[model samples]
Target: MKTLAIIDYGMGNLHSVSKAVELVAPDTRVLVTSDPAQIREADRVILPGVGAIRDCMAEILRLGVDDLVREVSADRPLLGICVGMQALMSRSEENGWVDCINLFPSEVRFFGNHLKEGDVRLKVPHMGWNEVYQTTDHPVWHNIPDGDRFYFVHSYYAEAEGNPDIAGRTHYGIDIAAAVARDNIFAVQFHPEKSHRAGLQLLKNFVQWTGA
Candidate 1:
């Protein structure tokens, strides 16, 4: 059985994510912990976060999860969600420019003050379901359609430095990197736990993936 660690750096919706993982894959051992040893022992790791980037970064560094993430993400099937996805980037424009794990060569930028679709204005947080257009095929996207809608609640989105790393894209006020993958890592700006069928399918796929 696979052991999946949900890294709890005191900043994520750990219970919801853990419950979602369990519901998707009952056989897999889901460990929600902040201990580095437990994280190292797990076959797969999930980096999940919510709230401000500054506080998230502060907690991550304080708990030494920043190093743990870098270490485990090197070879395991690492999944990042929401601000967790943003933290994987080199930097984030949130909270006046915060440095991240630099796992992916990208930067997180805010949605700006004025965002609109035609004449109608869109909310800053980009809350609710939005269609994610798959850009490339991957094990995580198996059984999921190309333009499936996923739940998203983020003000900032990742902007990859290059196009190759982009796995999916979505439009709010502009086209943004909704999902990114490279090697053993796959990160999404949306919350799979809160996204219903499509989201559950993704979590199921992640559990079965071998990181090949």
Candidate 2:
């Protein structure tokens, strides 16, 4: 009867994420809430977001979920998705530069206006499926093979100050940190819910993970 909490600050794709988690791990209780008590009490926490970083940070601070996230992530299995992952960084170059939760010593930078792979130019959003190459072995990657493609729809990507915390990498025009991990915390820039089979497998691993 493990309880999982999806922090709802009103900016995430909560319904799809919750449904995906429930489908992958039928035994676990998935609670989508903004209450600090429920979030802190859950066996695992998921921080998810899909929107502008400026609005996302504003809501997170206004709702006091920032403190709750920090409290739970100290020793619990915590996963962050999309903008949720960006929010964990120290700062973001989005919307004239904004501060974030600083859970990891990193920064989120935009893909920039012009991006190309050889002579052809790539779009700014970097939308669609791309392969994620595992940089380090981790429990969350259990049963999931390397070089699997995951769904991505973001303009900004995380850049860790050092390479030690990066667990996965993907190339769009250049290498980008697709996933990051340290202790009980795991976060990814891509949306696992929208990623199909490999995505579901990752979520299953997260649910069964012992946080060791």
Q: What are the lDDT figures for the candidates, one per model? A: 0.92, 0.93
Across 1-212, the per-residue lDDT of candidate 2 in tens digits comes to 99999999999999999999999999999999998989988999999999999999999999988888888998889999999999998899999899999888888898889889999899989899999999889999988889999999999998743656899999998889999998889999999999999999999999988785
Lowest-sum lDDT 10-residue window in model 2: 156-165
Please report how far candidate 1 places residue 20 from its true position, in Å: 0.7
RMSD (CA, Å), candidate 1 to true, equals: 1.1
Candidate 1 residue-wise lDDT, 1-212, digit = tens: 88999998889999999999999999999999988899999999999999999999999989988888888888789999999999998999999999998888788999988999999998898888999999889999999999999999989998743656899999898899999999999999999999999999999999988885
RMSD (Cα, Å) for all candidates, in order, is 1.1, 1.0
